[model samples]
Target: MKIVVKIGGKNIDFKNEDYFRVLAQLVKEGIRLALVHGGGPQITKFLEKEGRESQFVEGLRVTPPQDMEITEMVLSGLLNKMLVGIFHRQGIPACGISGRDGFLLEGEKYYPASGDRKVDLGRVGEVKKVNPRLVHVLWEGGFLPVISPIAADREGESLNVNADWAAARLAVALQADKLFLFSDVPGVLRDVEDRDSLIEVLSWAEIEILKEEGKIRGGMIPKIEMAEEALRGGVKEVFIGEGKEMENLPLFLAGGKMRGTKVVL
Candidate 1:
């Protein structure tokens, strides 16, 4: 199976090797996997240490020109290599890469459309195209690709992209069978405070209604929005679930249910 998995920054706990172990097991079982990761928390920490306050516009970080350098270093340089090293320890031949590598992802500057107030998200980009050759070559050569979401603009400069959206575009380009965004939450919940209120499945219509009803807000808004784009872009399945639920991926693929929400068209 061809699958794209995304891991969020807040969920990057080295102590919890369960997610890594599960991914390794799947790869050993002959699954073609590509991992896209984000280091938002780490970026924030480093930015604050440099006296830059992290700001956001509609859940998307409002990066400044100065912050772009730091973002690229943390995402493409540090976190990307660290993840490749982890996969190496799992006995997997993994290659760390950025979207800028071979222009795998080329994008234009992004502008937020939701907010009533105008704000600038410097160095932020939305994907314009995806080149799948590098990823396919890595997979064919028995190497797992650990991707950092750093896009290149027309001027060949780096742009910080949301990892979830990167994974979505990559999934569409790869024509992946499944796409999973693993974050801290179990799934889309009716009540943010109640884990038991987790919604097992959501359709596009329902998601729109939920948005209007204000059930979904903050970071989750873009997560689901990207899932919708992937679904519309010809990906077979997409799931917004917790990383731990990935341990049950085999069963889920075998037609069993899991804890995370499955976003369907």
Candidate 2:
């Protein structure tokens, strides 16, 4: 079974051996999967060390040109290779790559919506086209790809892309059987302030109502939107859950209990 998994940077931990073991086990079972990772925490830490200020707009990082180098370095270099190393320790042969390599994720600069004008998120991009050639080649060679969400525009300039958006795009392009979005939150909640209000199952119609009622807002909107897009794009299933619950992959694919909100069409 082919699956696409996107992990939030906050949830990534060197101590989190359970997560890597789960993924390695999946690979051992012959389940083809690719990992797309975010490195927000690492990037912020690096920026602070470099005396560069970090900015955000609408929950998305405002990556100025100066910060772009650090962002790419942290996301595509350090974190990506680190994850690959961890997987290697588990006996999983992982190939670390960024969206820029082989034009894996190609797009244009993204100017987020502002009140009247577009907010310039310098060096940020949207994934317009996905070239899965390299991914397929790696898969054929029995290598699991661990990707960093760094896209390139038409001019071959590197642009930071959100990991969730990147994973969803890759899932669609690969026609993956399942798409998993790992978030800091446990799941989609009825009340953002209440962890117990996790919505176990959700539908597109319900999503609209939730948005109208303001139950879903901020960063989660993009995640939910990506889930919906993945579903609409022919992905058989889209799952959003707490980052730690990534261990539930086997159970989830086996139709067992999973602790997350499953998005459906």
Candidate 3:
């Protein structure tokens, strides 16, 4: 089965051994997997080292020109290669690439407005188009495509794209059988402070209710929204679960069910 897996940047520091083992197993199973990753924490570290302060507007990083340069350096250069190295060490033939490579992803700039304040987040972009042919070619050639969230425009201007949105677009483009999003948390919890209150399955209607009741708030809301969008765009299924508990991935794929959340049509 073809799958698109999105790894969150926050989990990078955790060094989840299970995650790597699961990935190796997937490769051994001959599953066509495309990895999409975020490196916000790494970017933040770089910014901190450079004595640059980062501003966020509505939870989206407002990247200026210099910040964008650093972002490209970290996401494409540092984190992307790190993942590739991990896969290679596991004897999996993997190719690390940026959205700018072959113009796989192209997007327009986004300007978010908050009341009277209009923020100009330089280089921030939303995924507008995806060319999955590049990924398909790699997958057909027996190579996994590891993607970093950095797309370019028609004029070759690099833009910072949201990793979740990029993964959803790629999943739709590839007609992937499933989209897996790995997060630090277990899954969508009914109560923010209650770890045992994981929502195992959610239909569109159920998700709407959660949103209306404000049960789904903060970063999780966007993750769920992205998964919902992917489901609506024709991807067969989408799973959101813990990156640290990578052993559960195969179980989740095998219809064995997981403790995490599943968004289905």
Candidate 4:
């Protein structure tokens, strides 16, 4: 099965050696994988170090010219290599790439609709196209493709693409069997503070109701929205949950018991 997994860039500990082992095992079982990762926390850290204040609009980072430079450096340079290294350590053949590579992802400047006005988010992009050729070739060659969320505009200008959205678009482009959004939380919760309130399965309509009730807020809002779009775009399924849940992904996809929230049509 082909799957796209987008790792959250928050408090996740990607260095967990066992996690890489789990991923390697899945690849060995003939599951083609594409990984997309975010670096929000890292970007903020670097921007602060350079005396630049990080800003956000509706959970998407506002990337000015200088901020775009820093973002590309951190996401494509630092985090991308780190993940590639992790896979290599597990004896897994992996190719690290940015959305700018081979025009894997093409986007344009984004202006988000906020209230009655369009908020001009500098250098933030909404994906306009996805080229899956490079990734498909790597997957067929038994190599995992790790992608960073840094994309380029038509004019070759760097733009920050939200990692979740990028993964969703890739899933559609690849016609992936499933898409997973790895997060710190277990899954979508009926009550934000209640761990036991996890919703194992949710529908698009239920998600809307939750949004109206203010149960889903902050960063999770856009992630879920992207997942819904992926579902409509032809992806068979989408899962959202903590990274630990991924350890049993192969089994989960095989119809075994797995813990997480599944978003369906």
Candidate 5:
């Protein structure tokens, strides 16, 4: 079975050997996996170092041209290689790449809701299509495909994409068995601030109601939306939660009990 795991680099501590070892175990167990990663914290650090402030609309970054440049540098260049290095240390061969490589992610300009004025989000782009051939090739070659979220526009210009949405699109295109969005939180909580309020499972209708009631906001808004998109696109199952939930990957694929919030149709 194939799985797509999107991990927030901010939450992952590469210094911890145990963390990467868990992932290496996945490969040892014969799971074909693709890792899509986000570098929000690292991007913010780069922007700050350059004396530029970061801005976000809803959960999306407002990437000015300069910001996009920094984003690509941090994501595709820095963080991507870092993750690959971690996997390598764990005895796993990994190919680090960005969405722009091999037409992995094709994108177009994205305009967010901002009334009639149409605010320019710079190089921010949403996934228009995903080609999973490269990912499959790498997986079959005994390598993990570690991907960055920077994609190319129709004109071949680089565009910044939300890694969560990008991973969802990849899962859909690859017909992956499962998609996991790992972060710091345990899962979707009834209250964003209350860790104990984690919701174990949610149907599309319940997710919609929670969204309507303003219970799901900030980063989670995009996560839930992407989970819904993945489910609708025919991915067998979707999970969003802390990285620890990865331990249950085998159980999840085997249709056994697993941790974290499961999104259902």
Candidate 6:
């Protein structure tokens, strides 16, 4: 089965042994998998090292022109290649490429609605289109494609696309069987403070009700929105789980009860 796995950079310490073990297992499973990863934390660290100020409004980072350059440098240039190396070390043939490599992802600038005012986040973008030809070609050639969320426009200008949205779009384009979103958190929690209160399965309608009741807020809001979009766009299933427990990926694919939340249409 074809799967799209998105790994977040927040808790990703590349030296972590468990991370590599889980990644190796996924590749060894012989299931076609495409990895989409975000390196926001790394980018932020780079910016700080350069003595640059970083700002965020409504959880979206405002990428200034210089910051955009650093984002591309860190995400596509550094993190992308690192992941490919990891997979290769596990005996998995992997190819790391950015959205700009083949225009794999096309997008337009995003103006987020922050309360009554609109926030212009510079080169920040939302995925407007995904060309799956490159992905298909790589998969057919027995290579796992690892994508960075940095996209380029028609004018050859690069933009910072949200990794979650990019993965959702790619899942739709590939008509993937499952999309696994690995975040720092375990899953959607019934109460933010309770780790044992993870919501295991949620339907679209139930998600809406949760949002209406103001239970799903903050960073989770966009994640749920993206998952719903993937479901509506043709992905059969979407899983939101903790990256730390990535060993459960195969079990989840096998229809076993996973340690994270499963969102269905």
List per-prediction Cα lDDT, in the order shown: 0.90, 0.90, 0.85, 0.88, 0.88, 0.85
lDDT of 6 by residue, 40-135 (tens): 789889999999987875456789887898999999989999888877887888899998877799888889986899888999988888998999
Steric clash count of candidate 1: 0
Can you list the residue pairs that collide in candidate 1?
none
Task: Give the per-residue lDDT digits (tens) of candidate 4, residues 1-265.
Answer: 8999998887346657687677788887888989999989999999999999988777788888778888999999998998898889888988999999988999998898878999977889988999999998888788899999977898987789999999999999999989999988888999889988999999989999999998998778878999999999999989998888888887888798677799987
Model 2, residue 211: what's the lDDT? 94
Comparison by lDDT, 2 against 6, better one: 2
- Model 6 quality (TM-score): 0.93
In candidate 6, how many Å is residue 179 off?
A: 0.3
Pairs with steric clashes in candidate 5? none
For TM-score, candidate 2 versus 5, the one ahead is 2
Which digits, one per residue and each the tens of the lDDT, describe model 2 over residues 7-49?
Answer: 9998898887777899899999999899999988899999999
lDDT by residue (tens digit), candidate 3, 164-237: 88898989888899998888788888888988888888888888998899898756766888898898889988
Give residue 65's lDDT in candidate 5 (0 to 100).
93
Which candidate do you rate higher for TM-score, 2 or 6?
2
Error of 1 at 93 (Å): 0.7
State which candidate, 1 or 3, has the greater TM-score: 1
lDDT-wise, the better of 2 and 4 is 2
Q: What is candidate 3's CA lDDT for residue 5? A: 91
Candidate 1, residues 1-265, lDDT tens digits: the string is 8999999987777776666988888889989999999888999999999999998766778889999999999999888888887888889888999999988999989988655864569999988999989999999999999999999999999999989989999999999999999998999988888988998989988998999998898778879999999999999999988878888888888889878998988
**Which runs of model 3 end up more than 4 angstroms from their true locations?**
13-16, 113-118
TM-score of each: 0.96, 0.96, 0.93, 0.96, 0.95, 0.93
